[model samples]
Target: MPWGEIKDTAAERRMFQRRTLVMLGVAVLLLGVLIGRMYQLQVTEHDTYRTLSDKNRVQVQSVPPTRGLIYDRNGVLLAENRPVFSVTLVPERVAGMDATLEKLQQLLSISEEDLDRFRRRLREPRRPYQELPLRYDLTEGEIARLAVHRHELPGVEVAAELVRYYPHGELTAHALGYVGRINRQELQRIDPVNYAGSNYIGKTGIEAFYEEVLHGKVGYQHVETNARGRTLRVLERQNPVPGEDLQLHLDIRLQQLAHELLDGRRGAIVAIDPNTGGLLALASVPGFDANLFVTGIGVQAYRELRDSHDKPLFNRALGGQYPPASTVKPMMAIAALDSGVIGRHETIWDPGYFQLTKGGHRYRDWKRGGHGWVDLIKAVAESCDTYFYDVAVRMGVDVIHEYLDQFGFGRNDALDVRGARSGLLPSPDWKRGAHSQPWYPGDTVNMGIGQGFMLATPLQLATATAVIANDGVWRQPRLLKDVVGDTPLDEVLPKATRDNVILKNPDDWNFVTKSMIEVMHGRRGSARRASVGASYTMAGKSGTAQVFSLGQDEEYNAEEIEERLRDHALFVGFAPVVDPQIVVSVIIENGGGGSSAAAPVVRALFDAWLEGFADEETGAELAAAGSAGESSG
Candidate 1:
């Protein structure tokens, strides 16, 4: 028993000793490995670990600044920013995206379009932890619903953002333009560095023209984050500088008045202050709501606007190209008088129609019975087509082209607002370049009476009328009056003066101006019907542009024509003849006669504008008379 027990005890002791050694060796090896790893991380790879740790704890995010406001001359707000609520999501923090979306759909009513947009945004290669916009312009009900069940929705949050808004709605849509969400096309055009925080950009008009001024400088903030990459606190922030406010040259009162006068008609009216390049009113009828474009117009609404028959999206004032018609008469008369093609008192026999000797094409007058023998002054006053036809042929196409071009015709005016179309001032070179054709005298005769290849934008016609009103001192038409803020008015470069045809004889200008006055004030004037009881005299010309070509012997029967096929009506005029304050150009689509359709609109505009001054003068006169009577008593 003693010998066996001794052997078992020795074996047991030996086994215990081996087990203890193995356990100690394993512990030592683990300690060595852990120490080596600690050295590698703390010393050798210090920068890498530090950066990773910093990334987890601190984040630098962009903060967008408030866009500046746009106002009319009278301090009426045109374009502004309003607070909007949106639903945002961080993709990295969202677990099981499809499940979350399904849950959200149950909790809140989500549209297919909204889901599509959300999925599209998630697919973008943005920072995983950065918040991305999911749904914008959320209703109060949606916001309230989300708030009540916010704890159930991880990675989803409601955020307040400043959104662009147009207060005047459709009235100033084209002129003021509107801001829209940044798209791929816009991103490519914008400066990547500066636009890092910007989500909206100006798409057209003054907004596009002054993007740099309207869009403020971007800012940054240092933020703290939690383990889930959600923002904990904003550690540091640099306040953003707001964009410079713009005061436009447009008068809201006049603009509203002009827009009201246009009513439901599809047309354009542009009025300019003759002294300053300031545009008083720019009215394009059937305008769409600019607010629709601010966020993103739905496909249905956008398609409707794009396909509408009246073309609400179209900017008729600046972009619609139409034949100047007889509105070009005043300008042509100026050209004729200045070129010595016709004397003011010289008479041309109009036998109902003008026959081109070479082509034998008889261009008829508005008056079928003919204006008979008409002098230069009388021709302009009556808008005698045969007389202008005779003068145009005598003056030649080259002279007409050169003179009209000088008056901002056939070329862009470089207006403050963007998208100005250069009207066609056809010439020999233009015909050759544009249509690869030779110039003909028949073409000259047609162009002479604002027909043929002659086309003009409402803006061009308005600006030309302004030049005549200013007696040939052409100022570049401007929409911006001043940039308010620390930026001085001098900071904006003064618009360069453009001189076209300078009147060699001042008497020629006076003669043409006087004749235009007679057009509204004369006994037999075409626009005489509208001139009835006008407080101030208006100098204007009426034009009827044919929608379809007539045969040599065919008469223009506006009554028999369909409304769409009727003649386009046009009128251009300046008020108070001697001291011209406002110059206007009006065009009525498919409206039979300029006197009947277009001139009346201008008369209303003139009445509206003059009525303000008349009111002020009347008030002053009554006050003065009361004081005088009191003193006399």
Candidate 2:
């Protein structure tokens, strides 16, 4: 009876109503939170989300600039750009690089080298979406195969780019140098934004020296891409500035002639336009094709070049240091005359040899018996070693170093010849520091003959000869002739570091010039035979740089020694002997005699230059070509 009386209908109704209302409140609160979050994402943070979405579809790319054209002074193309197809891959777009690379190797039939280089490049620093090259210069069949499978490969594509090409690859290799793939060290130093897509960089010679001028400004583009990073269309574009075209002082005809003269022999020939100091021909024999290096040479090909017996890669004209031998006699003759060490008519008697002080060391003359009585003019003409020995002893090394330095000896005097060696110029102080020995009188005697410690490069010899041809003016040797741009050629080149060597008597220059002429036309001149049929007056001095020193009693027998052990033939001189046009220095490695081997080469060069450049307009042509050539712009 008590339980029945305790039942409450109002309380039960109130409890049900409270539970329903609480559930309704919870649902409304959750709905409101969801609505606010959706509004924040859709309207409040609209820009942020849209930008994030666009980043996936739109991409910015760096466009590499077109490398400049290189031309000879006569408008002959030396270096130009040719388009090629390359296999490229973007790592960010590649889901699995190693797996993707494996796919590419199979599809393109890529070599181990290409794969290896690709892996190496991947490890190197690169931009976010930069295409790393997998294979270069793809064949038509290879391109077709890649296209068929390109859809299957998400991050891989074929790219077209202009690669450096040398039209006269073997002929102009050392003169113009070459470009190759950029390395890790180069990547780090170059501007990250500008060089993003530039893969090649100048490696040596003129290419390396004028890289900034050769490589134009980089451009950019905005492109729309698909999910796999394939470009659908370019949204915006910026054109790249092409590198400036350069007209070099090189004469291809002269270059070809110099190379022909050096054929079947190891040697170098450096020709300079004396009036302008422009390098006409810089030839080093056994040259390699520069085009091989442009797109990255194969391992086997590079190894072959690196290990060749001829050393084709070596720049003999700029780097070969040989004894200038009798070639420097002309320079020394002026040094002796101006320094007052020898009178113009002073005679030095020779009975084939000279002793340092009675019987110390009988330095033998080139001629077996004697030059009889050799005056300054006679000594230079005859290449009388005994006379020069006497003058060298009288002048001493101090005076010699002083005068030779002014003539561009013992130092690289080229304005744009990169990698040239500063050949050793021995001095008393240099002797003390280098060998820890005192300067001996015998050293001075050897210096007289351009033996012992003296060394000079072909460029140095040419530069010195140029001074004589240029009338004691030291115009620095250079390669740049003109530019096809707004910039002046003078402003582009380095300021010539020169010390005009004005002799005490201006007549001394003429006297020295005449003596050198005798070296070509005189009856007793060493190079007289080579000058027999010349239409123009020429001046030259022949020299023999002994590869192996002879003992005091030993005589030189060219036939007995190995060809490599024979004396190196050298000759330096200029043509016409009046307002001279071309100055040349020739060095023949292991050639028997200067008069026989080197003199003929110089004579040929002289004949080619004088005869080819000869005409009524020769003077004007010479002046335009000689006058630190201005740009056509």
Candidate 3:
């Protein structure tokens, strides 16, 4: 090797060594960058990636709380929770919803309606993995079939849920109401935070009125889940508070008794504890089964209920508005005495018809043959339309309207129950305001006998009867006694006015009560047939409100008219007149002659109540006069 060759070789070797060192450095730098990036992803965002992975494996779901129970005053269950197995679906978990549903239908009989509802629920904006109810109250056979094919279905699930049950069925349906599955309408209205895990909501009646107390507060669980959204473990849980129980004022025994008395009739019966204003029995005949509404009533069942001629869904006790008929006579008599329009003993001659001097309209009495000369007491006892016509002419509509309004007649009772209709109390002003019509003299005469534009609900009539029983003390009628596990009801119902009746003479109350007594015990009492063999004295007035007007020459022969076209029978009374404890109001639709139909029903109710009282009192006489005066004539 020459010296130049040695120098060039040395330079080449140095350059090769430098290039090797530079390559080694570049490789080390690339390796360090790769290691740093891997560590950053694995350690810094571990939780975010882990959650995503766990979601694909585990499924977590919300468990709705059980609804509260409802009981009658006697501890009989009205509304309760029953365990129900239901098929549910999670649309997000389903690969092909239509195909899955088709398979589901093949496994279990699924109607078009069920499929339609399921599809609708799927379309609604909801959180992923949230179960949508597909079918409720699945039979054991259906459950078994679904379980056998459980592996074929991924998104479908069967779960036990607490569904509302009404054991009494139709008997207590209107009062207890029912609960139904939560819907979009309810979702928007409900507090999402509170109802985060809730399934059902109160639809109507007492259930709806006290929903807050009945629906328990929602709870939360912090759960660990897998990539499939399956739950790994519950890290923390806050136990849910169960709903408080409800004890209503309704008496099941009396309620059943009243229901029996109505017996296939379309009407209403309301019985109240005169002393406490607690509703004993508020029964509307032709009631529906509340249980049908719980899990979701079928379209056919719902349509039948809605379209039925009997109107089984109608709540007549609280909602039916009808002319009070001659049941208003006792109140009118009291009003007349209080207004100083007629003396208690003042006699009004009845020629079977009343004619206003100015108005040529002849207001005919119920009796074609004259009731003849009758006083206020006799008029009320015999329910003489002519006599009341005379008193009404003297008292005028203003005086009657003012006095009746005070007694809750033609007024809303503002009952705790939802959908209570305030019946029309048509005065000259009310008529003018509502119908844009002037008051007529004939209207006053019609009102005198509980006819014309005068209307009242069974509840209002019962409440008014209670006030009359208490000597004008108008206690506010109440349905709910108290809510369990809560502060006592804060509302102090208004006291019955001590001086409700403006009658200066205290004897006036005595006189009217005496007249009512005669109506039951008197021989000529219109309700005489119903009051046969009465052990206790009852004060009542029978009323017959014409469904359609008959011409002056036309006689009201009930048999001649169609059954639906007949008059409405009304009866209002309080038992054991001396120390009245129960007040009853009954109305029978197109039942003809309050004395014949309505009064007999009331008499039966009184008999049942008085019989119970007699048993408790060891055969003590509830009323001093077993038989007072019988004067229907």
Residue-level error in angstroms, candidate 2, position 468: 0.9
Stretches of model 1 off by over 4 angstroms after superposition: 1-48, 120-131, 489-497, 613-633
Q: Could you tell me which residue pairs clash in candidate 1? A: none
How close is every model to the real structure, measured as TM-score?
0.89, 0.92, 0.90
Off by over 4 Å in 2: 1-35, 613-633
Candidate 3 TM-score versus the reference: 0.90
Residue-wise C-alpha lDDT for candidate 2, range 535-555, written one tens digit per residue:
899988888898889999998
Candidate 2 residue-pair clash tally: 0
Leading candidate by TM-score: 2
Local distance difference test scores for all models: 0.81, 0.86, 0.79
RMSD of 1: 6.8
* Model with the higher lDDT, candidate 1 or 3: 1
lDDT of 3 at 582: 87
Clashes of each: 0, 0, 26
| TM-score pick, better of 1 and 2 | 2
Q: What is the lDDT of candidate 3?
A: 0.79
